[model samples]
Target: MTSTPQERLRLVGREEATPAAMSWVMSLDDSDSPRDIIDALGLAPFVSGEHPHALSAELERVKPDAALCPEDARILRTSDDESTKTVLAAGEGWMLRVLRRTNGTAMLHVSAVTEELARTVIEVCSKDATVAEEADDTQVSMGFWHSGAHGFSRRERTIGAATWPEIEQNYSGDISAALGRLMALRAEDVSGRLLLLHGPPGTGKTSALRALAREWAQWCQVDCVLDPEVLFSNPGYLMEVAIGVDTYDDSKRKWRLLVLEDCDELIRGSAKESTGQGLSRLLNLTDGMLGQGRDVLVAITTNENLSRLHPAVVRPGRCLAQLEVGRLSPAEATAWLDRELGDRPKPAVEAGGMTLAELIEARDHPTRIQAAPADTTAVGSYL
Candidate 1:
């Protein structure tokens, strides 16, 4: 007395089925096979796509009214303190999911019976999410890169700093002149692909680079590599940073400047011995075969002196500009302090001139105890 497959399927859910479920069951025809009925109930043959962008308040504007899916939310969260959130919503024949993180990043997934519906949902959610804008002239959009569990990832941040003109007085006169030339460079003026800034710490090297990024924001994309040692040691990681698609515009790519800070060990005269192929790979990325056809520039900051760096790195024609970001001269330091202190009595300038950091410290706390400078000869001891 075994019933047909259709009868078995209908009977399985009969007792517990809601009115809507029962109505759907009754709509099944005799011509429909068990597999066809199951497929129809599960919404098969749907189109799906995903888009990622910076999380913004505009997500509230997504159409079809996305709602929270409590069951699926925070499943990927490692701890209760985590800030990742997930929401989902479904309409007549479409479903959308949004996963937003605390770091201002989000991923959107949409599924629908038609391709057009999926695309429309994505467009609505991503319209204003991907735009990178600064709040003011003092801030510039910069990308920060790091290798994570998910792989290499970059997050765009609006970094705030003084303009080159505002901070030009911070560096030595010679260094300021060289940097002025470098900052004023047009795309055609790029003779070499590497930019090297070598000096002891507290000389305003990092500050200068920040200003440089703001100046070139119009034509060059600046990305600071957080883990440069890993970048050079891992070929895959280097390639990912070097040739990865520019998210800004794919049609006409902009120049990129990759900043590696405190890379003393990676580019020293004995780098080949200490870092192995790390130095070679870095050289290749700057001007060798790896650099050909790519509008990429490598800008490195280190406490190592220029003479102590690898010959290949500082050789003529390799670096677009090799500037020594040293402390200002005694006269320059005295003038800076006088200008900064104004009517207040200025602190005595060090006989050997003063680094920007020292000058700032002096201006803020003229009487604080000063420790001896860290040993710069040791790699990674000073930034």
Candidate 2:
């Protein structure tokens, strides 16, 4: 029987891929010959121009039938003004692939087929550069993961997020002020590793997050975790997202805010009792030692009640800020609606029970949404 790729270990001279070795691993090229680009990148140490090298030997043993194995490699040519082309080898299951563009921005991709090995492999590789110095060039960044891997597709300066006043123009309660203080909270403000934003949907959790991201653009980089459920379950996945591989280790430790929204399953009161991946892993990520001194800050948005959150998560010194995002009052909603939707004759639009998202939707389609009936039923009110 043929062994699977996951069973193999990608060893480098009796050791796994190290940061320095990874830099060398990525420098390997196969554009001209199998691992041909290695010469172009001047990989004098990693490979030889010889026909059969250690790398090909590794591949050959793993995939005897070349037709059946899917080759994994990429060549990125980045030319803003000056152009450059870089190539790296790839194959399914424990392969070394380098994502390098013409502009010299490089990201290393190293994954083992199994979770444990993948974790160990990535742990070694990222101890040096997953995102690397790329963080310096990215002011505002956005990323998402699929099947446990992700990339920063774009960078932004402002993202055009609204300012405090613009976001809270309809605020009739103290949430806007609370948001002010929450966003203003700095590293010195608290010892907690997490921030909790709980409320109904459409209560401006997203807007407030944006405002905070923009407000703290100087030192904070907001990263919205697209898949919170798989984050803790996949060791290799979480390592990259939680402890970015390309992170800088300067005196001024860089910070990335991992924002998980609508994570009701991960922060519920029953989380502490469970041993499974859902809430338990999240608690570990937040309260466990791995999160203790890490420069990353966790932000979770959920419609679940704050009181229902596991005590371990919301306990003293664990959360930097816990803000309840509620909808605007009737009076505030009236004024806000007037601002959002041009002033018109008064309509009995019951805004008290409505969320900000609902109000905005109504405002946008005023013709469709009729005035509130004299007697309407209570909303389940997730927002």
Candidate 3:
């Protein structure tokens, strides 16, 4: 009778067999099959999984209690400042390998004699690692979605952003009032499913969105779609983002705010002719059959004027709020400059008044503003 790989592995003990297994794994290239490597190394019946956005501190806490194979450790210098580390360790009946990258992505592979041990270790590590990532009130947790070779994937990060109260004065009185009401909205207060902000670039549309994320951080999970065109055009990708699994606690279902920025072409008057099914898919995500019963809100920012946008997009009752984020008035600009540049000489405001970005640039470099040509556009004019 022939002895199986697992029976042979148990006879030698995992700790004794680890050095040889690590040597074999290190010899394999990225194109090699992982299962083949495991079988060749007598590590069958093993479980493997990956954890995205894994915290370094939590990984350090969950490292297997085993002897390290320093000789087989690999360090990949991804860039001048970033490096990826892969380490292998083994105990009496188990072998653990960890690959951690500088960007907070990590993968763990464990080979144990029993399936229960392998699953329990993975579950405990994932749960404990995520718990440590909960953000405090000062920071907002945001999810970013992108389409990769594997498909649409989401990664989360905690970012520090100014609260609505801190940046309320950055906008004109009318714009501020409109945004104040939008920011104060609770889940039950939501009437429509769309939030539209149309304006020229550099008027603080992106900044306002960030502040809105912080204000609604308690009841909403804000997710920014990196490629809105692909999201709307590809039905599969759209479905992945629209029907995302809610990973929050079951006690309360959290609403999702999907932010699509600089989507001028997708919602313009001729969008249907130019973008095909893109505009229709976006409408469906907001309030059409696709949006029924789903607690999802779509917020879009475009540089086009409200009149230039497609009628279907800005139709009444479809949007919760649609506000034009225009530049500040001459008087409002003067007040903002006075507050920002306390002792410095102020720059002359443009005839059409200055956008918030222009105000910031002027406050930071008053001399540059005075020397630049009158036709020169502001730094974020095309944002």
The true-versus-predicted C-alpha distance at residue 311 of model 2, in Å, is: 1.9
Candidate 3 residue spans exceeding 4 A from truth: 1-99, 107-121, 127-131, 134-136, 366-383
Q: After superposition, how far is residue 21 of candidate 2 from its true place, in Å?
A: 14
Candidate 3 accuracy as TM-score: 0.70
Clashes of each: 0, 10, 0
* Cα shift from native, residue 211, model 1 (Å): 0.7
**Predictions ranked by TM-score, top down?**
1, 3, 2
> Please, what are the lDDT tens digits per residue for candidate 1 over residues 1-383?
86564663342223222222232242454665443433333222231122211122223222233333323323222112266555554554455556566665665655665667666666765764543442698888788889975467677777887788898998888889988888888777888999999998999989988998998988888899999999999998998888945555565678899999999999998998999899999999988888888899999999997779889898888989898999889999999998898888777777899999989987787576769976788866756
Candidate 3, residues 143-170, lDDT tens digits: the string is 8999965367776777787899998899
lDDT of 2 at 64: 17
Q: What's the CA RMSD for each of the models?
A: 12.8, 12.9, 10.5
lDDT of each: 0.73, 0.57, 0.73
TM-score for candidate 2, residues paired by index: 0.59
Model 1 residue 151 lDDT score? 66
Q: Candidate 2 at 236: error in angstroms?
A: 2.8
